[model samples]
Target chain A: MFDYLQYVRQENFPHIWCAGCGDGIVLKALIRTMDKLGLSQDETVMVSGIGCSSRTPGYVDINTLHTTHGRAIAFATGVKIANPDLNVIVVTGDGDATAIGGNHFIHAARRNIDLTVLLYNNYIYGMTGGQCSPTTPRGANASTAQHGNLEPAFNISGLAIAAGASFVARGDAYHVKKLETLIGKALQKKGFSLVEVVSPCPTAFGRRNKMASPVKMMEQLRDTVVSVEKWEKMTGEERKGRFRTGILRDIEKPEFTAEYAKLIEKMRPEE
Target chain B: MSNDRPGKVRMMQGNQACAEGAIAAGCRFFAGYPITPSSEIAENLSVMLPRLGGKFIQMEDEMAAMGAIIGAALTGQKSLTATSGPGFSLKQETKGYASMAEVPCVIVNVMRGGPSTGMPTLPAQMDVQQARWGAHGDRGVIALTAKSAQETYEQTIRAFNLAERYMTPVILLIDEITGHTTEKVIIPDASDIEIVHRKKPDKDPENYLPYRFTDDCIPTLAPFGTGYRYNVTGLCHNETGFPTNDSNEIQCLIERLTRKIEIYEDDIIRNNELMLEDAEIGVFAYGSVARTAQAAVRICREEGIKAGLLEPTVLWPFPTKAVLAMAQKVRAIVVPELNLGQMAREVSLASQCSVPVHKLGRVDGSPIPPQQLVEKIREVV
Candidate 1:
């Protein structure tokens, strides 16, 4: 235990975030990663859009901005360009990043701005009660989907890898150490990095659907998610109904903030 | 300035003057979408602002355009964005959020021809009503009009002051013609201007409440990461700024949002009076269109017609006192806008005893010329 308590609100220890809420686990992982990297608390900025998981920044005691829903990346873009010195991270939920903010997320990744996007995927809209989010399972019992959800879920890691994200990884909150390693790796990677954490939302997605409790949710995640290398060796039937997880891609183009700072240095040069 | 007490003289277009005004008012961040007439403001800002170590970002959409400015402003950057008519329409929702959250920002809407994507490259005044009612609610907007390139400069400076002082989004209404029609302007050294900064919390981060109001009902704003642990939501928020759908909170917020503007009528609104000292008929106009009215006034004067020009620098507090004062002296008001009759209606509403408020506008991508304005002025006079 690397004293992850520094990044948590212990008074909010039994947080409104219920048991089996992977948000806490992912948040803990993020804190551990920050600690491992020894990132300066003074120079770190964490921004988030609206959602249950977007609330992570407020607990960390860093420079945090709880911005408008679906516009965390855009706000982070401004923050990065403004300072260019601070380590800017956008903490967004599945719906916040993938749905309403889809355009901004793609464009930011495409620009390869030195932004780290931590996307928490709990598979359902957790904040305003359980609603059908963009990442909800194809057939799930959500508020909007009485019978079942009809739309196919978005493969977020695949989308990030495709949209020119320099580093893309997927991990479940159940594997805290491995997840924290991925987060630290993503943070240290020299370009736009995304770590999609498939967390469990017991209150909304679990309780309503009679899914696993906290411990059993971790067990289900451990049982269901297979690493990409192992899944590549698995047969088609073995991979059915399973969302593969691992470091999907890691290749650099150009880092956004440094390049911009370079251009500014070269072009303007203090007049 | 009817008082003819010349303060500062600068040769600038209505649009370029707007950028200078924003700069003079200490705006450090500008994010905008390129549209006709308003592009110069963005262009000048991009060229000049960075020279002063200010930041400029060209956003992807008008929605993001406004959002970037609002965000930067919340970061304690005096920020602004300029766009034309269609882009102005796109910014309405965000502008509404700025009003509700009282995020101080100056938005320049260079009026262009359209109801749809009608005129991307032309000028219009139809956006007058849109500037007021464009956002969803009954929230009051502080708008200013520019006649000369010089007035555009001065009013744009005023727009920022009013915005920061009042903690609201102030709109600088310029027409496409004024935006494009350039004039020579001397960029004064930075020392010659009075700039007002948006007031922020003096209390330590631990004791700050983001939207706590002072006696003026105008509260100080705290930038993000400034240690103010408060939320700014589009929903009706109490002083602490958490979303409260409660009716009492809702009414108090809306009333303060509206009255903070409406109550400061004398201080917040601005316009001009030209030869109205002895005239019986007035030519009311704004932006570049007001120039034609100014020329028309001179023409009417040469022909011995009693005509004057009321160029409103502030649009939404609607310059009612000017209209009422002129209404007592003049039998009719000839309002020439670039669009169909938006500001003319406000003139009618503000008029006393059914004074004839006639509108002469051109929405077909052409300016209402001075001769045409002169004819309207003579007929009304």
Candidate 2:
């Protein structure tokens, strides 16, 4: 078993998450992955916007910044550009990343800046007590959407891929083992890499959808997720309640900081 | 005093001077969006920052630009961003974060006419109040204004200096006219300029407190990626840099944030008083309006009217001491602004109604002409 205690701020324990929240599982997977990758705590920065997942930065013993709602990527962009040697990771959630922060989300991907974005898609705004989010499934019940959510869910990984992110993948809270593997790959990727984890919100999302039990939510995830390769073989009708997981898109490109370093060298005046 | 120092002299626009000034202040990171009257600062830095081994990034928007600079500042880089009215409004939330987090950065607002995109190409001092109270919280704000390209160059450096010294966001407010106007600026020699960097923590990493209080109230900030691993948040945090709900701790955090700047108010305020030695009437103005007010004061002196000018380069922390002293001597004060009586209200409060404070304002997207100020000064005298 990985000793996650080494990475966590022990004094901040009795953590803020409600009982059986998938965000904690995701957090465990992240630390385990970080440990496996041998990332230096002094050289790594974790930035987050406001949300339940944003609390992750406060718990981690690292150079962390808890920024305003939806501006974590923008802040992370500066950290990476200011010193490309530092490993910068952004921890954000569905509403924080896609609603108020959608512009920054797309632009950071477009810049292809060196940032690892761990987007926890809990399908609802859990911190604000289950408000309808950009990724809230259509017809799902939420505090704001008492009757049902009117908007279609966003394809988060597809959005990253379309916005020119060099690496994009999907993982789930139920699939914790594979999630670590996916995160490890993302941490090693050269450009803007995104791992959109379909983490479930048991209290806010599950209670309204009649899956109030955290076990039921995990079971639902287990039944629905297919590997990316297997997903391609399924017909459109067969993908009704299911989603794909694994490295959905990966490519090579000129990363923003590296290109900037080259520009600095080329523009330097002769001594 | 070092204006006559042997160095490069060039005629440049106020916005260009600001970019060069930022470089002189050891600003190695610039994150900005293209906003009217302020875009030239970004354009010039785009070419200059790279050559000088600095970093320049044209962010997605004004809010991101503000956020990026704050992030760069945390990583031990002197960072800056420039914007106008609407963009400044967008940046308020992030600017407030910079305030609460105690990040040292500079924001340059080249003022343009607005309540919202009112006029992009013209100059106005409408953001005077916004720069101080634009963010939601109660914070000690440092905002500086300039009258010409030469002053803009000098004040830009001072803006960075104050930011580092106090570990707070400093606003450099120049009107569109000042930003667009071209003038000769003498770039002081490298050895002639004094630069200030944020104090780095020398304490043991095992007991590092990012927001520890001191007698001076200013806290040393360790840059990220240097052995010190700490958390920074917009939420009210304890000395340990972690959020705390304890009321006493919250009270201390808020008070310290304000006190750090207030205790040093005398050192932060900068104003120029001209020919006020034996004058009975005073003209109070800033930015481009002050340039015209100086001319109007000269006109008043020539016409046998005892008139003087009080030009405050630092707008916030209000310059109350100087205004109070001037109020005691002058019979009446005339405040001519590009906006409708923003600073005039401050002048009234600062003067404590000892004498009547008169306002001469124009929001027609143009500067207050010297003749208008002359007429106003004549009426007041």
C-alpha TM-scores of all predictions: 0.88, 0.99
- TM-score, prediction 2: 0.99
lDDT of each residue in A93-130, candidate 2, tens digit only? 99999999999999999999999999999999999999
lDDT of 2 by residue, B134-194 (tens): 9998888999999888899999999999999999999999989989989888898888888
Q: Rate residue B226 of model 2 by lDDT.
A: 94
lDDT of 1 by residue, B158-252 (tens): 88888888899998888777777677555555676667887868898767667776678887877665555455557676776655658987888
Task: Let me know the DockQ for model 2.
Answer: 0.93
**Runs with alpha carbons beyond 4 Å of true place in candidate 1:** A1-21, A31-44, A55-63, A126-131, A139-150, A201-219, A269-271, B1-14, B225-230, B245-250, B352-354, B378-381
Every candidate's DockQ is: 0.32, 0.93
Model 1: residue B260 alpha-carbon error in angstroms: 2.6
Q: Is model 2 an incorrect, acceptable, medium or high docking prediction? A: high
lDDT for each candidate structure: 0.80, 0.93
Candidates' interface RMSDs, in order?
A: 3.2, 0.5
